[model samples]
Target: MTSVLDAKTLRKEAAEARQMADAISNQQDKDFWLGIAEGWLELAQAWRSGGAPRSTKLKEDSAIGSLCLGT
Candidate 1:
């Protein structure tokens, strides 16, 4: 179940990642953290929309039925 609180947390993490990226001087480290920030932003957006049922998580006792296991 995706909640507003979960989206808020993701936004906070994204902000922290962006701050860390800004503080770093190394290009590789900056890119990595920036990527993390982007990922968190995407997740937050998804959660805010409808991420829980959209996620590709199988219920207990449910078996994988296809190779293209995407939501």
Candidate 2:
């Protein structure tokens, strides 16, 4: 739950950074801001799936079955 909230916040920050980057005149500064935006967006995407049972699903989908879990 917290992760999902944080991810939303991060994505908002990324949008702000992108806007700032677009407003800047200096190429270097623009690039830096864009980079920050990209980083934030990536982190947000990672966090957005926080509640997913990814590991368990992967284990279940494995062809090697319980061997993947050392069972």
Question: Which candidate's lDDT is highest?
Answer: 1
Residue 21's lDDT within candidate 1 is 94
Give one digit per residue, the lDDT tens place, for model 2 in 1-71: 24445877878877998999999999998987786676666656667766532333224343222322565
- What's the residue-level lDDT of 67 in candidate 1? 14
- lDDT digits (tens) for residues 1-71 of candidate 1: 24455788878977998999999999998987886676667667777888643333333332211211342
Residue 32 alpha-carbon offset, candidate 1, angstroms: 0.3
lDDT measured at residue 27 in model 1 versus the true structure, 0 to 100: 100
**Regions of candidate 2 where Cα sits further than 4 Å from its true position:** 1-5, 51-71
